[model samples]
Target chain A: MIWNERIECATRDEMRIIQSERLSETVKRIYHSVPYYRKKMQDAGLTPNDIEDIDDLRKLPFTTKIDLRDNYPFGLFTVPMSEIVRLHASSGTTGKPTVVGYTRKDIQMWAEVVTRSLCMAGVHRNDIVQIAYGYGLFTGGLGLHYGTENLGASVIPISGGNTTKQIQLMEDFGSSVLCCTPSYALNIAEVIKEMKVDISKLKLRVGIFGAEPWSEAMRKEIESKLKIKAIDIYGLSEIVGPGVSCECEEQCGMHINEDHFLPEVIDPETLEPVAPGEIGELVFSTITKEGLPLLRYRTRDLTRLHYEECACGRTLVRMEKCKGRSDDMLIIRGVNVFPSQIETVLLNMSEVEPHYLIIIDREGTLDTMSLMVEVQEQFFSDEIRKLQELRIKITKQLESVLGISVNVKLVEPKTIERTAGKAKRVIDNRSI
Target chain B: MLIKQLSVFLENKSGRLTEVSKILGDCGINMLAFSVADTSEFGILRLIVSDPERACKVLHDNDFSVNLTEVVCMNCPNEPGALAKALQILSDNQITIAYLYAFSTGDSANVVLKPDQLEECIKVLQEHKMELIEASTLYKI
Candidate 1:
């Protein structure tokens, strides 16, 4: 699972050489194989020869998710389907899911990088790894599955769902490492409390959570409940999967595998590179992806890149906690609102349940925002006057917190539809 | 028994009351017996609407968290201690009331009861020979 440690811990010259070589080859592959890439490159009046090195990346046409989707299926593959070993794609709402093909070489590389990611997270060969992400075409499951195997760790591919079964396997397998989305992890912890599962009997030592963006508060909460260190994993279907980057034991930021993937931060608006430390949209160039390679892929994932050496031995680039996707931001009355922000506010509010929805609609020409909040039954003596007073308090709190006047409607116990997967918290009806 | 109810999960807020009502008015669902169970940040608006299912869907489909629950409804007098008389009847029969709310149907006060002691409450209601309104009868009344 050696992923070019020199490039990861490269001296300035060696790093430049590695990027220059991979950047050139990626350009050549896209130009030769992908019709969409060839068209985009032709439109830019560029050829594979023009992108001689990493600095010449400016000369190359940037590949976006739209390009991948528009082309669809095997449109981006550098090789034929016979050469491809596995296919993975995004489960994002609709259309021919952005498909990715992995050559046998590509799968091995993926397993290697994923293993590197786990090792960076302090997972050793002896640990029992429980992967709870969805399998099938989704990369989270199999990618981690192979990676844990690559790490020579006993992997329980529990997959996602059936929380009771997940617990059963964790207890039976005596899993030492847990992997799943942070929300599901939290839900599992909640179930354990209700069922009185002996968490102390569980051998889980570390948990890696990703697939959806979450906050530091959530991380601490998960860590405390599981009595294990919780770390963030960053990746998307377009680039690789869960192992493109991951938080090290340091937990300062997720370490991006610099040799395989080159990271950049760009102004989402200007489409220009942002200053190093500034928060902006994260872009990745798959310098080494053989099948379905993407160059300067606009991840739309908002994060920052830092070249600082981590406390761990790895000198790979580190990415800050993703704030939110540039696309996921909601413009309510000219104010940019992120569902994560609302979640942050709600999680902080002891009075509110974690379940909530932000409803945006057109009231005349202006926008109206209403948060449907659920009140705990125990908190109220079932008194109406106090309930009315509580409602007013919530409204005031939302206004203060969001810096926008929002109406808060109180809900009863378990009224909101519990999301079985990712919570659909934002409903924007302005389009209708 | 069948009764009008709006089962909306609401985060507590000042104008939220006005908002759901305004939407329901637009949809033509009248709020009959309404009670809000509140926490600090959110509240649940439990209502007996003229149409239970329609009201539930209207609130739910609009992203307002809604739920359905069944409770016994009784028509009592508007007079003071009328509720006490009912409570005593249940207490004497060792019935525990989980929660209750009052709403007026014309001049008569109808008490909504969600009893903790369902069997005892039913026994007391039957022993006292209090008229148990059928779903159709309650809807028509």
Candidate 2:
């Protein structure tokens, strides 16, 4: 296959030369317009001039979720609220939701980044893309909704939750591309099988699954079932949503749109920056966003950065598929096991449903993980002996995937609760 | 004429039925007739215990979600088509079987069914042409 050579061939010196000036201008804009940025810079004893180059980004104070909340609504916005054309927010799981705003230019830039991500995943104007993510304050749906439309593709805005309806629309409308959370994508695939909706008969060519964390095993399963390319998109509502970076056709790493968003890996423990190719929290700084131009925003997502050019000709910074979050990491048996890793293995198994709950409990001093997985009706045996056998298989899979042995409980169909929005996969019940 | 005293909701699981059984057993309440209506989420544990008020309190105290029902318990023989003939009676009166379950003591099987679209299955039984057995008759049996 012919690789995208132009982007790959761009000299590092030239890329840095471009990122420096844009980064400098973004720093100046935030510092002048938003009081939050002014205070952050003042406390750090740094001026916009101090951030002369990308290397000087360390001299700047890091932005965080608390800062966003402190500046609730639009206080942190660089532009006036009147100029903002659109706004989005995160799932707001902890407390209040982190909202984002987009100006007319920012919306165009968002569409551009999403389009770039889609192109790397080999989507085209000829494809009929289905948007299944939530389309409200949550950015997953609307971001992709606009980007797919902007790309000139025939858009099917099947805003999530009604799996049967999504399947019907996919088949009836000849949708060639699907975008939703990874778990939902797997769910739609299951419904397609039960409904016997011929995916091959449909026009689906590629799938961009994101919003919540997923694993490679899920990607592989979705690919086989839908018989199309499955790619992961990375973004948070604080920065933008579902379009900061995306998987290239090679599916190795997600190509970050370095032109708009600059990514950095920071030592979460030390609050200092780490070199590329090291696992650390991924940080991003938006250059062209009007509503919220985050400078050195701590994404809290753990991943390694790759500065290499992609097969799809895009001169952008790239990051590996995120390993897991620092907060959600379960240190069991001297190893950190991500629930997504366990999920990956389960999705690969034919007997398991993608719907599962990672129940974290304390057994003595060590943390114990019990995977509550749903089985299709046929394999759901009530006999404890049969359930034990199934549990053992899951335990082996977990040990192999996560390098930690965990107890797997085979739950009956629909035993695990389903969420209408982002699915809550992990239930850490360690406190009580 | 009599009414089935109670229909309690219980989850269909290992210790669920055992827990309910132990509650009534410990309360010194004799189950004159009892049956279970099973489904995926939960089952209705219908009973015509000798003292339903005491039985309801015992089961409720044990955390079993209970409901007071007035179901018509029909005594059917263990012979072929015995259930068919009894069910034909309800069908002839257009009484739908919401759910039904059976439990037999030595001689007769007490089948409890909640007729369809009726607030209480007792009123429907009164409308039918069958003789209703009362609590005393159930205790004597």
Candidate that would win on lDDT? 1
- Give per-residue lDDT, candidate 1, residue A190: 80
lDDT, candidate 1, A237-278, per-residue tens: 779888999988889999888788888888989988898799
lDDT of 2: 0.73
What is candidate 1's lDDT per residue for B19-134, written digit by digit as tens?
78987888887666678776666556777776678876776566565666677887777788877787888888777775678867677888888776655676678777665555
Candidate 2: how large is its RMSD? 12.2
lDDT of 2 by residue, A315-366 (tens): 5677998877755545442233555566667778787768788887755323
The per-residue C-alpha lDDT of model 2 at residue A251 equals 89
Relative to the true structure, candidate 2 reaches a TM of: 0.61
DockQ of the two-chain complex in candidate 1 = 0.16
i-RMSD per candidate, Å: 6.3, 11.0
The deviation in Å at residue A263 for candidate 1 is 1.1
lDDT string for model 2 (B58-118, tens) is 7656544455665666667767898887777667767677566677768767676656544
List the RMSD of every prediction in angstroms. 13.4, 12.2
Query: What TM-score against the true fold does each predicted structure earn?
Result: 0.61, 0.61
